[model samples]
Target chain A: MSSVRLLVGTRKGGFVLTSDGKRQDWKVEGPFFAGWEIYHMKGSPVDPDRIWASQSSGWSGQVLQRSDDGGKTWNVAGNKFLYEGEAGTHQWYDGTPHPWEFKRVWHLEPSLSCADTVYAGVEDAAMFKTTDGGTTWNELPGLRKHGTGKDWQPGAGGMCLHSIVIDPTDEQRMFIAISAAGAFRTDDGGGTWKPINKGLHSKYIPNPTAEVGHCVHHIAMHPSKPKTLFMQKHWDVMRTDDAGENWSKVSGNLPTDFGFVIDVHAHEPETIFVVPIKSDSEHFPMEGQLKVFRSKTGGNEWEPLSRGLPQKDCYVNVLRDAMSVDRMDECGIYFGTTGGQVYASPDGGENWQAIVRDLPAVLSVEVQTLP
Target chain B: MVRVELPAHLCRLAGVGHEVTVAVDASPVTIAAVLEVLEHDYPALEGTIREHETKQRRAWLRFFVCEEDWSHIGMDAVLPPAIVSGKQPLLVIGAIAGG
Candidate 1:
């Protein structure tokens, strides 16, 4: 039997919603680690029973927990994320170098081939990996040691390495994205990395198309076509054909291109999704209406999916990590909002329903297609 | 024996009752000894109340014994007789962050 599990991480806790593939009739399971900020929760693509969550509190600091039996129980793993070497410096808002600092883990990405291996993306922007099921994390320093790292600056979100894409065809290659620092790719399994924001243009920065310093909100890649990537930047919706070596504007027909969170359909390599906000400064839906623009032709042509979404007086921003898609034959799309709602569309984005309307403001949403 | 009380969230996380009593393993027990036992018994609390590397108390946490703030004192300093004997439960509180 096929099934679906939705892992919803909110500002206050984490929840698990399960359904028997029908995508109807769900059983909502938690508020796990109540009152704590569950920055991200994800299950391993290779092993659905294995899940990882990044739980943090201002009072308790950061803690990583691993669940082997699909969230039935959790073991607190390594929370220590010590920067290797001197933990160098990056440019500050004032254009002066400021030392790098370790903040909470912003996202956890499990290995596609093994359940025990996972990656942790942390703020103050750095990358880490754990091969022993999150028991310990070792810094993959090459990403930060890139020559131009000192020139990287933080966006208002604080310099976070929020997006990670594993190249399925090549075991040794991987890609990571950082806000205000653009994107970086590693050909040697994270040992080394290079900035890949060649065609990106950010008017706010000193150079519109500098190699780095673009506030990329999120990036997505289809498993089938790992070379082609889609990105939702702070301003433009973009696409990369040569695995991020170059990018081109794909904002196309989006009403407003300034938004966070972008994802590709599980089965369609060219079909993508993006929730357009009014602008970077406004952070809300345009004209008080919420619409999810879907581009079936990759980009440049989009149609609004508002059948079941709020069409009037709705004002909630979707954070960078709050959108995801499941892999069932029919395909499913799910997203959470800052206004405490988790919306789901079992059949693509044709129609929607709120899985839970009043959760604490959601920070991230991930769904696993279970077989 | 040293009786101890953890903050609400910590208690729930540690899966212990409001008060926990642990064998100090030595006389004139210090706060450090109590924490060592607490962490050993509840491994989930490894870096929650105090740091794993520096062993420094989390900035948002407080320690108290006999109604006196012991957070400023060294972790190795001996506790008062009342606390060491279980007459007073050393309190580990999450310092309020409200303005």
Candidate 2:
């Protein structure tokens, strides 16, 4: 009998929720990585033995950690990218200091094809890649070179690369979404990237191109259909079939299209999930009502799943990387909220149950199945 | 010496339903001392206030002095006279999350 483990990362620490395959009784063990802000945690789909986490501190910028024996223990693997170099070679570059300085790691994506390959998105709009199992990392130069002119502005979290999706079969192909920089993709690895933001709205740009900052929050890809992608933007939920060459709004039926995270089923490519929140006003759920909606045929239509959720007026917001679908025959959907609660659905979003409540602010959720 | 206040969670852990006061005599007050006093008097908060595995400060927990964040302040840094004098309570808060 296989076991299921849910690694819940929170603002204060990380918790590991384990259960039998049925997920009926869960045992919570944590706050692992105790004193660190764990923004993202993932168990490598390619290699279940490898688990990775992205952590940050108020004073300690960002750190990447990994574990081989599930979440029993963790080890820090890399040095954070600090703007200042050693002693006295140089102090301040120009009148203004260098911009490599970062305060936190906002997201982490372990490549589906490679066990050691991982990507980290951090504060101050920086993206880093670790090919050697996070022991060493290199900054994605193309992203650094992209000019964030007056039109490309950073939001509350700064202009960070919050989402990165690498094609499972094609390691060279990848897509990255910047908070205000829109979405960009690379076919020949990171050698070059092209903005693919056509038909997306950017309040800052007079004419938003399919290639640059359009206030993108998150992006998800269907498992079977490599080209099919879904994105949650500031004002709309959009989809692209031609590999991001073009996009169209598919969120007319949602209670509110404004959402932070978007997820697709592991095996059923057509089935997708999203947590809808009231936009424009502080990004909370509608009238404090939180619902996770699933769309079987892409984002054309959605069904609400909140059977076992809180009955009170609960206005909770789910962050990007806060919701995920476990890779199994009967897929399980899990999501953590800012309100410090984690909800799980064994039958993919058909019904829901709160696995753990009032733990802390949940920053991210990653699920792994033990063989 | 500056004073600090405790939220409900920390207060419960401290074994006191209400806020308790601490004295900081030197600069760069170590979190260890604060925890020692808390544990010696409160006891109930011993396990939760520190890391379960390493006994270090939990990353998600924050220490604040009035409106200023005390995360970067070294463990040895001296507390302001007001704090030592019990004028204001050093606030130990759990970071808030949701959005």
Candidate 3:
């Protein structure tokens, strides 16, 4: 029987949730680095014992932490992040030049093969890699220096590289998404890159169909199908067939497509999940009803999953990095909300339950299946 | 051993109680030497108080001894006699933000 561990990062701390194959009863483990905002925490798919965390605070700034014995003990990795060459500036929210600064790390993507290797996506928009575990980090400057560094502008949330997708079949190819900057691809393994936001359109930017400048919230791809991707943009649910070369709106019959997270099923690659908020201005669920919509056909059609969820007077919102899935015999889904509840669906979105109803507001959630 | 007091958050991060005793190994102990010892003894707080690359004090954090702000003072500068003799504990304070 396989077990599951949920690596949850919240506004105030980090928690480790463990359960047996049944996943009915769970044991909650911490607020490990209490009082700090745990932006993200992820376990290596190859080495289940290794974990990485991004911890930050308004007063203390940024820190990277790693754990070797699962979450039993953690060590602070190096936090010295410097640009490779001449650092430049990006456009501010009001279209004025703003010097590129390291605000905080948003995501950490460990390599599929080696637990010691990982990629960090940071705000002010840049990518960094750590080859010798998390002891040291080196920026892959080609990402920002490739071009478009100046024209890139910050979204209301600040310019951040929040998503990094590594092709399961090919290690040399990768995709990354930046808010207010659209999607980008690096087929040559971070040495060179190009924008892949051809079909994306945003009403917030001056040019709705420009080559860049789309507030992409999240992008997910089922490992089995590396080329196909699903995107939750500022106002639309989109799909790309040719690996982001082009995209098409699949908002379909969704009540309102303004969402922050999008995820694909573990077993069924075509099935996807999204939680549609009221709009950009109002970050609550639609009509004060909390629902998780599933699309079996990959887009254009969506069905609400609210059996074990609050549907009346429920006014919570799920952030971009707060939703995830587990790899098991029967697929399991999990998501956390700004309201501090972590809901789990052990049976693939049919019946849901709150794993931990109270914690600090969750910032991110990730799952690991143990053999 | 030099007596030191950390803020609540740093105390929890170092897995210690409100105040901690640091082993200052250098002769004529200085603030920089004290911080180096703290970082070396507590791996979890490698760069929490000062920058690892530049070794500069974090902007929002201040160093104090006996109610005097020592944050702007040079790191290599020797501490007051009371702090060096352990009569007064060195305090690492996180400046209060927006009231």
Residue lDDT tens for model 1, A1-371: 79999999998889998998878788898898888899999999888888999998889989887888998887788888888898889999999999998878999988889888999999889999999888889999999889889999999989999999999999678889999999899999899998999899999999999998999999999989989999999999999999998899999878889999999999888899999999878999998888899999999999999989988899999999999999999889999999999999999899998888999999999998888
C-alpha lDDT of all candidate models, in order: 0.91, 0.74, 0.89
Q: What tens-digit string does per-residue lDDT give for candidate 3 at A1-371?
A: 99999999998999999999889999999988998999899999889889999998876778888899999999878776776777798888888988888878999999988888999999989999999988788899998886788889887778999999999999789999999898999998798889999988898788899888889999999999999999999899999989999899999999999999999999998999999999999999988888999999998888999988988988888999999999998899999998999999999899999999999999999999998
Judged by lDDT relative to the true structure, which candidate is superior, 1 or 3? 1
* Model 2 chain A: ten consecutive residues of lowest lDDT: A86-95
DockQ-based ranking, best first? 1, 3, 2
- The TM-score values for the models, in the order shown, are 0.96, 0.75, 0.95
What are the DockQ scores of the candidates, in order?
0.71, 0.04, 0.54
Give the Å error, residue A152, model 2.
Answer: 3.3
* Model 2 Cα shift for residue A319 (angstroms): 0.7
Candidate 1, superposed: residue stretches over 4 Å from native: B26-28
Best of the candidates, TM-score: 1
True contacts kept of each: 0.73, 0.00, 0.53
**Candidate 2: CAPRI quality band:** incorrect
Ranking of predictions according to TM-score: 1, 3, 2
Off by over 4 Å in 3: B21-30, B73-78
Deviating ranges (above 4 Å) for candidate 2: A82-100, A147-151, A204-211, B1-99
